[model samples]
Every structure is written in structure tokens, then in C-alpha cells.
Target: MYALIVIISIIFFISCLLFLDYQLGKRNHIKNLRFLDFEPTTGDYNLYTNGDQLFTDLFDDLRHAKKQINVMFFIVKDDDISHELLELLKKKAQEGLRVRLMVDRIGSFRINKATVKQLEQAGIEFTFSSTPKFPFLYYRIQRRNHRKITIIDDEIGYVGGFNMGQEYLGRDAELGNWRDYHLRLIGDVVKDLQITFFDDWYLNTGESYDHIPEPTSEGSKEVEITSTDGGQLEDVFMTLIQQAQDEIFIGTPYFIPSERLMKALLSAMDRGVDVKVIVPMKADHLFVKEAGLPYLSRVRKAGGEVYFFDLGFYHAKVIIIDQELCDIGTANFDRRSLFLNKEVNTLIFNKRFVMDLRLAYLRDVQDSQPFDDHYTQLFNLGTKIRIGLAYLVRPLL
Candidate 1:
């Protein structure tokens, strides 16, 4: 009985320390928080749904870039495709073109120290964004730089879901074909992307870059670049859902939304707005799919349609409202993305582009199966237990 008392006392002491740490972290985060917003800028964009074609065009642009290249991604796996990209960047650096590369410390943990040394030796500026530090260690560690952006010569840019990994190229046996949406853009919007990149670079390293040219319209498409560090995405999503009139189409890998966003979605359905959300049937991480079950069920009960993409992984983060406004970027619909991560998305207000994206969304829907009561009944006892556990700890998911 005396030994048992000692063990219980130790456990209680550790729990108290952890609780204090969490409270401190939360307080520090709120103190330094600032939200971001940008007006719509004109640009020319081409949406790439296939990985092979995207890399092809992206590589060609990188090779032809004359002045500078800025690249950042959440994940850069230590694999063949990543090696290829690194080699290309090194080659470009050798050619006297400025090259800077940044990746999240957590998301690209697979990249070793030797690779970074080689990049530095090749005259490429490299740094890891959002590295965990003291004071608010837990909260800072959880916040990731999830933006995937590339700017070449201050004239061309690429943004969206594709990351530097063989899995993204559909080589993983478990995930057969990778389906995603990315944009290749040219015009004034590239300047906005460059400014965002510069700000991130300065945060990582205390270096600021300037000489950004003035914005000039290159096409007829109007695009707004919306970026969020944290605590702002829920409001953005809610505003979009509230303003949606004719229809709302959402495609994402994870469907775990906050209470307010879920209610907004349900309210939109009540207002006669057609709401359809498509998520992957296969899960990439633990507890993610299960966590979304309750929210998806609520949506279905409110006359909203839910789809399970059966072809492969559906990793696209896109939302189309009335086929007039489209959002495509690195932000997912889950709580972690909506409230924790640093993300960037483009809001495009162009009928032609929205119509094209709508067609692609419909094609993906055709490849999906509906989520109904029959599907819910297929979960086993173990899955049901996991679903309950996931829902309980959803804020961290």
C-alpha cells in the first residue's frame, strides 16, 4: 500500500506539470497572434489535377528560370522524387540563379543532416520553418508551416496539394493513384506569393528580401491569396459557407471540422444550398477518418451529401461555391488545419476557372460512393470504439 501511494503521487506530479505547460503555451500563442488578409489580384492560372503533368510543367519552368527560385513545402520525403528535386535546385544554384528552399521541421523529419549540408554547400539557401523553441514549446511544435509554394523568376508560381514525395507520384502500393489539385499561375498574383515567401523566410531566418516589382495584370482571372497562421481559418470557412447560394462542393482528405463550421454547413443546407463533400475512403493517418464520422453524419442528416472517393487517396483541399468562387490550397477542413497550422489558399473569382474546376469535381464525385446508413453500419466494434476516442481528442487531431 505504501509503494502504491508513491507511484500515484509521482503520476499526479507529472500530470500537474503537463497541465501547467499546456496553459502557458495557450497563453503565449494568444498574445502573439495576428490574422492576415489580401485583396483579389489578377492572374492567369492553369489547374493541374494529375501529378505527372504538373511535375513536367514545373520542371520545365524551373529549368528556364533566370533570376531566382523560391520553394517551400510542408513535407519533403527522403525519396527518389525528392532527390530529383534537390538535384535540380542544386544545379540551378550552380548556374548562378538564386535558390532558397524551406521545409517544415516536423513534416520533413525524414530529411537528414547530410542532405541539408549538401544543399548549403551547393550555395542554396536552406532553412526549416517553425522549428520548436522554448517558452511555448508544445504549442509552437504543433504549429506547422503547411504551405506548398514555388516561385520562379518572380513571374511564375505553383501552389496547392502536391508535395515532394514518391507517394505523391502514385508509387506507393497502398495508395494506388494520387488525386489532387494544384495551380500554375502567372501574373500579379506571383508577386503576392513572393511576398508571402519572403515573410516566411524572414520568420525562419532574420533575412528580408525586397525589390518586388509592381503588380500588373497578366490575365482576366481575379485571385485573392488568403493566408492564416492559426485562429483565423474557421472564420474564413464560415464566411464562405454562409455566402454560398446555389451550391457548395468540398473536397478534402480529412473532414474533421469545428462545431461552428459544421453548424454553418448545416445552415447552408437549410437555406437550399446544395452541399456536397467528398473524402477519401482510405485514411492516411490514425484516427483522422474516424474523427470525421460524427461530423459527416450530421451533415448527411441535414440533407447534405457526403461521398467516399474510392479510386485512391483524394488529397485535394478545394471548395467551390455556386461555381463562382473557388478555394484551392494547403488547408484541409479539419480542426488542426482550421485552428493550428500556417496555411495559404487562393480564392479565385473567375467563372471560366470555376466552371472548369466544377467539372473536375463532378468527375471525382462520379468516382465516389455515397455515404449512407448502410456504410455507417459496416463499422466494427473496434472501429466504433476508435471513433468515440477520436471524437474525444478531436481538437488535437
Candidate 2:
């Protein structure tokens, strides 16, 4: 009995430690917040669509880099674009370009040892996130560096849902299609993204940068950085969504936003704001779809517009408020993105960018199927019950 009590006590102690650590860590993170300095800078910021177009723009910006090129991604596959990018990096490195690359271990499984060796041979610096034990610290690693950031000369930056792979370049013969949203910001926001990359690099390499550069765009950018854990801007995002006065428009592939976000949407509708949401007709993850449907009732009742895009897969995470503020990044509307996955998004407040992003959203709407009144009739009682159960676990998803 004493042995059992001791064992139970040990278990209880570990649980309490983890809980306290998690909470205390979050508070510490809040104190050292990143978004407190987000203000717009001067530059020609724009909203871009499609993987190929985004890559083209990124490569163009990279070519214009005078000092450094840093990239932190989750996947780096050996497809057509990946190979081409590697070749270009090699050429640029031969020209003495300071190039650094990092990929997540789980996200880049298809990238074998040979490709890594090639990058090394080309004098490119590389790092891997989440090493498993044995020689590595094995398993139990949950937090992923899911941030998508690319900084060139510490001047131009790119962030969004696009990951490294054949699909991003739209050259995936297996799937035959890849749809995503990546933004190009030419301002001080790039500096914040650069800092994010530096933090990840230091996490694995134990090295620090001498001087983190600032955004060089002409005007200012009112952007905020949010995370799933400590230094969380979940409340910040929630506040922004709830505060929408005229119209609230969002496009997300996965639509499992937290209850707070859902309530904000419903409240927006209640106040007679035109609330609009665009989600994939067929999501890459099915359970997320199951979890998202139940929220539609309140949304529809509040007179919101829900749209379902039908072409290929609509994998864009975007939020536009009153056609003034726009958000684009890897964070989906789901809890996984909010509290599980490492996501990065940028909020562009310029009216021109908003108009352009709204046009892009409307262009996507052309290929979309509107989620109208028929949805409530589309699913039966059994489905609703299961989805409700699925939603209960949203925070941990």
C-alpha cells in the first residue's frame, strides 16, 4: 500500500509540475510579448495567391537580396521546384550569398540524406526541428516549429500557409494540384519574422544573431504575432474579430476556430455585420470539417454568409475586417492552429492591400459553392451529435 501510494504521489507530482510549468510559461511569454511593436512601415505590400505565383515573387525578392537570405520551413521536398530552388541557392551561394535553411523533421520526411548532403556541399546552412532520441532526444516532442518564414537581406519577408514541397510550386504530379495563400510584405514586419527565424535557429543551434534588422518599408505595418502557447495572441486575435464593425470576411481551409472565435462571429452577426466565411468543400482533414458544421447554425441564424470553395482544395487562411485589416498566415480557424500548431500570420491594414485581398477573395468565390440554408437540412441528427462531440476536444486538437 505504501509503494502504491508513493507511485501515485510521483505521478501526481509530475502532473502538477507540467500544469504549473505550462501556466507559468504562458505568463512569462505574455510578459515578453512580440506583437507589442507591430506597426506598419513604408513599402509596396501586396496579397499574392497560388503557390507558383508566390514562389516566383519570393525568388524575385531573394534575387534582389544584398546581404542575407534566411528561410525556416516545415517541409523541403525534392520535387521540381525544390530541386530548382536548391540549384538556384547553390548558384547564389557560389556568388557568396549568405543562405540558411531549416526544415521540420516530421514535415520533411521525403527529403532524404542525399538532398541534405547536397545542400551542405553547396555551402548552404541547414537545421532540423524536433529530433527524436537515441542519439537524438527521442519522442514526446509535441510543439512543432510550424512557422513559415522567408527573409531576404533582412528586408523582404514572406509568411503564410504554403509549405515546402512539390504542391507549393503546383508541380505535384501525384496530387496534380496544390492551393495555398502566401503574403509578401516589404516593410518592418519582415524584421519581426526575421526574429522568429532567429529564435528557432537558436533553439536548435544555440547561436544568436548580433543585430536583428528592422523593417525598411516606407510606411508602417500594424501586425501582431500570436502563438499556441506562451506569448499567446489568441485573445488579441479574438478581440480583433469581435471588434469588427462593418463586415467580417474569412477564408480558411480548416474551420475549427475556438469557442471564443465562434462567439465573436455570432456576435458580429447579431450586430448586423455581414459575416462571411469561405472554407473548403472537401478539407484535407475530415474531422475538422465535422467539427465546423455545428457552428454554422448560429452563424446562419445571425444572417452570416458561408461559402465553400470547390476547385481542387482551398487551403488559404485569411481574415478581412470591414475591408480594412487583412490577416494571412498558416493559422487555420481551428483549435489545432490556435493552441497546437506553430502558426504565423500578418495583418495588413492598408486600404489598397485590403481592396486587392478582397478582390482575390472574390476571385476565389467564383469557383466556390455557397453554404446556404440547405446545410441544416443536408446533415441529419446523427451527424450533428458526433460533430458536437468532436467540438468538445477542440482546445487540444
Candidate 3:
């Protein structure tokens, strides 16, 4: 009995230490935060809503590259579209142009060895970011490089949620229509994206390339690029929610938010701020979709509203506040994106741009099916069991 008591005491002590560490870590991140320094340069941003147009524009820009091409994606499937892109990179590399591509290993597990060999034989530099080895495989598995960025000649860049897949083009009949958001930017913002690609490329392959092109004063649109490798992103979301005055509109495919974000959203709703969230009706992961129901229920209980996109899989990560600020990027509302993955998001402070984004959000809302009390009653007993199981393994999802 004495030994049992001693073991229990040790376990309790360890739990206390862990809880303190978690709290202190968050506080440390918040204490070190500083106001973002916005770039004084201007840029032109073209938003692409459909994947067909997005990929077309991306490939066209790649074909026109004169100097070099830097590309990174979370998923690169072994399909016709992937082959087409691979061939384009090969042709560019063969033409004596620098071409480097990085894809997350786990996300692109289906990419066969023959494709990689082809890339190597053609002088195209291809590498996988955050591949797991023998040791610490579990630890490495959770930290994914989720950013999708393409820098063409250091003058033009693209960033958004669209990945390289046939489904992204709405070709998968099961998944149906694929709706997403991507931005093609030309100006100083390109330099910021280039820096992010450089850092990731060098870390993965030990290859170093540094180039920052001169920014052309094209249009007056203020934006800031925020990149996070498993730190401070939660604080960014919390800050944005706190600063919101009138309303906050968030659209993300995933809904497993951190505790602080959940509290902030609930508080905002309690204060009578219009807070609405749009999530995909059919998510890519079953566990994530099941796990998110509770959070949606909590938000709804707090007077906030939730909508599920019925038209297609809404994979865009966007947030707009009071029709004044807009955030669009690769980050999701899940803990993995906020505290584990390498994500990039751009915060735009231009009212006109925000207005356009607001219009887009309105369109999405029109297409979405709002979740009400009736929706909760539709969940059967088996689904509720699955949801409980999903919540138990939420961290991994």
C-alpha cells in the first residue's frame, strides 16, 4: 500500500509539472510577441476560387519562368496532373533553369519511386520535407510541412490552400466539386514568400539560394506574411478574435481549434459579436469531421452559428473581421496547423480587398447549409459513438 501511494504521488507530481509547462510555454510566446511590421510596398492580388483556373494559372506562370522555379506542396499525387507538372519541371530543368520542388512525404505517400527517379534523371531537384526515419518516427510524423507556395523567378508567387491532386480539380466524383482559394501576388509580398521557400528548401536539402527582387509599386494593397513552425500561430488567432469589433467570419475545412481559440470565439459570441463559421460538409478525414461536432455545438450554444458547405469540400482557410481585415493562407483551425505544422498566412489590411473577400464569403454562406438544433438531432447513436472516439484521438487528427 505504501509503494502504491508513492507511485500515485509521483504520477500526480508529473502531471502538475506538465500542466505548468504548457501554461508557461504559451505565456512565453505571448510575452515575446510584437506588433506586425507591415511592408510599405504595394502588390496586385488575383484570387482564384476554382482549382481548374488555379492550376492553369500556376502552370502558365511556371511555363513562363525565365530564371528559376521554387515550389512546395503538402500533397502531390501520382496522377495525370502530377505527371504533367513533373514533365513541366523536367523540361524547365533541362532548359538550364533552376527547378526545385518539395513535397511532404506522408501526404504524398502514393508518389512512386519511378516518378522520383524521373525527376532526378531530368536534373530536377526534388526532395521530401519531414520524412520519418527509424528513430523518433512518431515525433517527426506529427510535424508536417503544410505550406503550399510557388515562387517563379522571385518576381511572382502563389499561396493558398490548393494542393496538387485530381480531386482539387473536381475530377473525383465521390468528393464532388472542390472549392478552394488561392492568391497570385506580384510585388513585395513575393519576396516574403520567397524567403519562406528558401528557408524550407535549405532546411530540407541543405541547398541555399537567396534573391529578393525589387518591388514595383503596382497597387495599394497592404499585406503581411506570417509564417510559423509550431509556435505563436494560436496567439495570432486569439489576437485577431480579440480585436474584432462587429463580426468575424471564418471558413476552414477543419474545426479542431485550440482551447484558447474556443474560449475566444465563445466570448466574442457572448458579447453579441456576430461570429459565424463555415466548415466542409464532407471533410477529407473522417476522424476530424467527427471530432469537430462538439466544438460546433459549443459555439452554437454560445449564440454563434455554424454552416457546412453543401456545394463541395470547402478547403479554404480564410478569416475576415468587420469587413476591414482579411486572412487567407494554408493554416487550418486544427491544433496541428496552429501548433505543429509549418504554415504561412497573409493578413491583408486593405478595405477594398476585404470587401471583395466578404462578397466571396457571402456567396459561400449562400451555398452552405446552416447547422441548427435540428441538425444535432439527426446524429444517430453510432455516429455519436464515433464522435466520442474521434475526440479521444483528436490530437493525432
TM per candidate comes to 0.96, 0.82, 0.89
Encode model 1's per-residue lDDT on 1-397: one tens digit a residue.
9999999999999878767776788677767765556788889999988888998899899999888899999999988889889999999999999999999999999878999999999999999999988876776777789999999988899999999898888888998799999999989888888888888999899998767875455667799898888778888899899999999999999999988999899889989999999999999999999999888999999998999999989999999999899999999999889878889999999998899899999999999999998998898999899999998778777
1 or 3: which has the higher TM-score? 1
| Candidate 2: stretches off by over 4 Å | 1-40, 132-141, 171-178, 214-231, 380-389
- lDDT by residue (218-328, candidate 3, tens digit) is 556778888887667888899899999899999999999988899999888878789999999997877888899999989888888899999978898999999999889
Indicate whether candidate 1 or candidate 2 has the larger lDDT. 1
Candidate 1 ranges beyond 4 A from true positions: 1-12, 215-217
* Model 3 weakest 10-residue run by lDDT: 29-38
**Count of clashes in candidate 1:** 0
- Top candidate on lDDT is 1
lDDT of 2 by residue, 1-397 (tens): 9999999999999878766655554444345444334444344455667787888878787777777788878777767777777787776777898889888777777777888898888888878875543321211143455778888887787888888667666565544455678877776666777777787787678889789866556446555544333225467568778778998888887777767778878887778889888887775654677788767556766788788887767778888888888877877777656654566777666787788888888888888877776666778877777788777655544
Instruction: Give model 2's TM-score versus the native structure.
Output: 0.82
Clashes of 2: 17
Worst 10 residues of 2 by lDDT: 133-142
